[model samples]
Target: MIYFVYQILPHNCRSVRSILCSSLFLQKKGKKGAKAVEEEPVQVDAKDRIDFDSAKQKLQAVVDRFAKYANDAKLGKTSPKVFDNLMVQTDHGDQPYTSLAQTSIKGRNFIMTVYDPANIQRIINSVLGSGLNLNPVVDPSNKLTLKMPLPPITTELKNESVKELKNVYEKLRNGASLGKNHTLSSIRADARHKLTKNKKLDNLETEVWNEYEKLHKIYVSKLSEMIKAAETAIMK
Candidate 1:
């Protein structure tokens, strides 16, 4: 048996009809005891030709069904084995079962193993809490990768440290402003007040520096965790 494969395109119905009609000529033989007659090409009528429109509709239906199956597989709504069976059924047993098995396996792996929605949402929440912007990059193979902006807390802490440092410098520079200069004893008291202010400012600056370092370490650790999660999710 011969199988004829026809690819139909939009606005090419007339061309398809012509090609089909021209290729379907019927030959006639002479009487059994007599010599064979010369062959003549016969014209096939449009009504006698295969109904391409009906075939196109059937093929389109199959395509739509396959797409639905693929989507279901991706969403974890269908098992790989079930999806493979459906594909084979859609092709009316024409396609080999093993030919589509690998595709189904990949689809299952991507949906069930690689991109776990719950895990992804957890990662998203962590990123958001860290005040970082999450950016996803999808490659040509439909695999997802992530990019994140530096955590806002890091910048905020650094800015706060700079502001505290400036305040401490200003206070030290204007030590005399902390005391009144009314008399010698008052001037001595002013000196004592300046000393106390200087010590307070020094402690405040040290605290700000320590807080900045702690925040920087936290930002680095959270970013590393997010990167590891993204790699695990998309690099199967």
Candidate 2:
């Protein structure tokens, strides 16, 4: 004897008949040729039964909450250590100005400095002329300061390199898990040795080094421009 099973599932509150099996054999030959009865569970498509509208609404709510948190907590701001510090040396018997002010503008923080207060506007103009974003502020308790944004290309390249290195390390760790004899240090050493021969890793390292050089050049050029502008403004 054979039996057919059909399951009716609700799709958006509408009844839809879902056939699990066209025919299910109920009788089978036993060890001694006796008849045996067998039963099988019916399968249903879960996706067909799901309420898409409700799911989409719930998912949207979660996305909205995450967006709110990201904005409210300033999660998109880069860490301060990522920025290269600009140091200015002074003549003998004068204290070197390390930073004019450490302040936040538009959710990003900067260590700002100006050589002379009289040329502050010139410095600001020079920075703007160099196509860099800046927010100049004067505090009664502190010197005139200019907020500078980090170099986007350099930061992005560094972040990409870090992410790639992390992925490589994860692969190394996963490889180590296959053998109890392998330690983290040993794996790291092996990975370093392998990286020397790895074309991809070598290319990434070279790119990162090149980006650092570019960043240095940019920083020096901007600093020089600012200094020149300040001196010019002072003369006027």
Cα lDDT over the full model 1: 0.35
Regions of model 2 farther than 4 Å from truth = 1-77, 92-142, 149-236
Give the range of the ten consecutive residues with the poorest summed lDDT in model 2.
68-77
Winning candidate number (lDDT): 2
Estimate, for each residue in 84-165, the C-alpha lDDT of model 2 and write its tens digit: 2333333333232334323344444454556567655654444454333444445445566666554443545444434443
lDDT of 1 by residue, 84-134 (tens): 332222224434333422322342132212243323333333334433243
Q: In model 2, how large is the Cα lDDT of residue 9?
A: 65
RMSD of each: 39.3, 24.1
TM-score of 1: 0.18
